[model samples]
Target: MPAPFTADTVTVHSPATSANLGPGYDSFGLALSRYDRVRARVRSAGLNVRVSGAGADELALDEAHLVVRAMRAAFDRIGAQPPGLELDCHNDIPHGRGMGSSAAAIVSGIELARSLSDDGRARLSDAEALALATELEGHPDNVAACLLGGLSISWLADGRGAAARAATAEQLAATGIRPVLFIPAEQSATRAARALLPEQVPHADAAFNAGRAGLLVLALTSRPDLLLTATEDRLHQGYRAAAMPASAALITALRSRGMAAVISGAGSSVLALALADQAGAAAELTPVGWECARLEVSSGARTSGA
Candidate 1:
């Protein structure tokens, strides 16, 4: 049997996602137009991972590389040894700006593995693909939006742990929600951001965030006009503001500017008002030193590589 990867290299383009929609935290996410185009070609020589575009030249190309690790994980799942392959990544998303670079790499690797699997083609079902990606990315927020495409709302099942570090094998099978998200440039390590918390929060603030997270879903499916009121937050945003004070500040600015902006996921990015009427003009906010893009709420969050 010929190796699937041994054939002409397969290529894929994955979109990035913004998570935690202001107050929704972990549960809300939206897909964007930005992408990382991945081309995988099995080579007769040793494994070679080539990166191009955006921050490609600045990336590391070794075994511990995220792309390589993800590809290896996919092959291992199918009980097959990965063939040496040349991977070229046109990275359009910033490395650690809270976009979905990690998600794109994981999705690209999973797609490569599926493209090179035993049945000569062991593609993953959308749900299966989402599950595996969530496992690698450590949460469904970015993976679900990247794999499924669009604004999605996903949460741990009845009493599951935090979405960031939760064992998402089963949790990935859960449902998703929609949101308006933003990404800012004021960045920090997720762990470091998480470390700033005082461990306990006033029950009032906790309740405030919980109620808004719930409203985030309703604002999308039920009444979008209510989002201004629904997407408000108290817990994650306030705590993270210590590290990303600019995130909250910017959201306020956008709101005053008539844009419904919110902090994206953990920090450093902002998800601003995006809808049919506002989507086009939204890109104008490409502030100096900030890469702004017009993101949409789609169902399958994917784009053509070309």
Candidate 2:
């Protein structure tokens, strides 16, 4: 039997995320302070969606909307689809700028659906929620961070998504590191950026990345001083640099000044893991047209009004 929804309305806030932080490749992720908020209400009859901020002009307001699609998937798992839905999305995350905008939308939808059902939480454990989100997003990194928050390391176990937070909320606060993003006005598609990589990398490069990835975890948690060295990569960044030259140049410039910077996710936006003292300088290095923001490491998604 389908689980009946216990609530008429639910709201969820999902944070933006950056994945593949330096050498961690498809494993590392960090949630940012910015977020997208979605409020969904069960209705008696059809679908209604309203959008504002960021992708307001481009996003669909129908069943084709990513959030709606995610809700549909979750409802299917719960064995009941609402007769109708009303969704209002207020977004802060920029679309296609290498921030996990899509992941935020997907997570928000799933969380909202869970919040609406009487037994949704029981039916969808945290692991099950992560697995479903990963199936929808096609990777675990960004979605993991969006769900679990702070710094998360995610991987597949038996072909299902699994993740753990590397630092507690308190531990992350004590690190005194801020995430500074340099976002270009232009956008880069994840697919297009991915197409630039060679199918095979040299064994030497692979070995080099493994060592740095290990060091990166240590640096992010307890040793901010090692970040400049720890964030070095021999994997994806260099190969995709040509497609986002400005981002590539900015990262190089920031690193030369002793800051740890990398391409955020696929391309276009650059992320600098900056200590309190370095945050301002990191922002100053942003190119004329790019947007810069200094953000704290964020907590995971939250739902209310179920």
Candidate 3:
């Protein structure tokens, strides 16, 4: 699909993300430099989707599209009559690669809905946006990182989920660690990867991951040296290894070399937290078919022409 530049467009640039950054599991997420662009304009009374880039051929072009669903979800939340929308999506985030491509779409749509409401109200508040996105996303980590930027830590208490952002780009700059992603051609569905986890784990293993999650936060914020031990996980990755053997093997190999490596989100993409000076070090270890990129932690989502 062709993307035409126009003065009437409201556009958003949302970053792709690596979630579950090591031991934090569903509670952790990190935004990467790569992004997906969404351009939206108010239409009369229908939906139109024009997609270019990853999954363009396979993704829906109408109401069933993830972006459209998100917009509807947002409109319902605000008690606003939904407006017609025309969406031009340029998706770069790899699908099913544990990179939060879906989260990007969800955030883009919610923002689009906010940008197009007829009431001419102030833009959706951050809290409203987070709540709407979380309702559609089923968790807060990835969507929070995509919506709020930087690194996000989410948890559930009293059957309600709450998320907070940390490790902003400025903080990461001070920490002296770089994010290196190893992306494989093969895709592993998040649902399938999640299914591999057992219903129960050893009490010791659960305690181990809890301790590591705390250390991982420290490593991400002020203590880069602790990253080697901090990224270790005893929860989901090992159990999901069979779903993406290549990713599992590559993570193991990277860690063996003293790099702090772990599955990016679920599987199929590996993130190695490398020292800033050694950012390029993980590239040499990439296997034959996988791709590697060094990414900075993004600040947050941005919208123009809103």
Candidate 4:
């Protein structure tokens, strides 16, 4: 097939993702409607990034940026010399809040590379994109969700384990899932949240997380009522409670009310998986100092131009 790029410019809209999804720590993810839009084109002889929205002033505008790094990685993988690039980033995903901003940026870059290169007369395939994005992000949860949309189940495995590091996404048949996000004013770094987890969890806790994670898949597919139980986590959240007390508190409060609430990705932002009909109910429970939004599951990444 001919490459998708026929002009100098390519634009990609990559969705922000919420990973972990409660008990499925580091393994499950869901792509939200929110996104970061990136536009790239051949320009000059150097890399330049222009940013607007979320991290405009704080994020770098040079080649060292995550987007540039990912684009370069994609080029290197395909044995193509990267071109002089101009990147425009209109970011809506919040930084350092476990909303997969980095993952979105990485996917954006990889898609940009695929759109720009045609050295082998081939465009990037979904598997190639996922593999490269996973390589750059070191995990597939968020990246897979950003690339494939809906819900993603990912794992890294040794030969003896379940499966080698791989990711896949699915669109659920059950459609009433309404995601209400409670984004706090303060941001929590993913690294800091991860540091709070112990090297290993208790065996029973692991079993509990495993069971709930399995149940979660079922609940998400058909039984909305089971979400409260399915979303229970005995793995990562409590260990990192101190890192984002407000998020922890909000989660507790919602769950106590029989709502399926969880810390989105890591912390600082909470997600209440409510039924579409219960959107107003979830909105009514939004706590102070947090921005709330009702979001749907995004179909997937969309690329256009050239």
Q: Pick the candidate with the highest TM-score.
A: 2
Scored by lDDT, the top model is: 2
lDDT of 4 by residue, 1-306 (tens): 233233468899999888888998988888889999999886546777899999888998897889999988887776765547889999999898889999999989888888777642254566767877887887888888888788778766441101122222334525477888889888888888888889987899999999999899888877778999999998899898987888888888888878899999987799988887677877887777778988888866788885
Q: What is the C-alpha lDDT of each candidate?
A: 0.65, 0.91, 0.83, 0.81
Clashing pairs in 3: none
- Please give the lDDT score at residue 171 for candidate 4: 41
Provide the RMSD of all predictions against the true structure, rounded to 1 decimal.
5.7, 1.5, 3.7, 3.3
Give every collision pair in model 2.
Answer: none
lDDT of 3 by residue, 49-82 (tens): 9999999999999889998898788777656644
Candidate 1, which segments miss by more than 4 Å at Cα? 4-6, 120-128, 156-187, 275-287, 298-306
Give the Cα error of residue 184 in candidate 2, in Å.
0.7
- Per-model TM-score on C-alpha atoms: 0.81, 0.98, 0.93, 0.91
Worst 10 residues of 1 by lDDT: 164-173
lDDT of 2 by residue, 1-306 (tens): 134875467889999899998999989999999999999888777999999999999999999999999999998987788888889999999999999999999999899888887788888888999999999999999999999999999999988989999985558769888899988999899999888889999999999999999999899899989999999998999999988888888998999999999999997899999999999988888899899989888898989887
Candidate 3 — worst ten consecutive residues by lDDT sum?
Answer: 1-10
lDDT of 1 by residue, 1-306 (tens): 255444665777777777777676666666666778888766666777778776666677877767778888777766676546677778877766777778888887877767756453345555566666777777778876666565566655443312322212122213222223445555457667667767788899889888887776666554666667776777677777767766667777666655567766666777775544555455665556766665444443332321
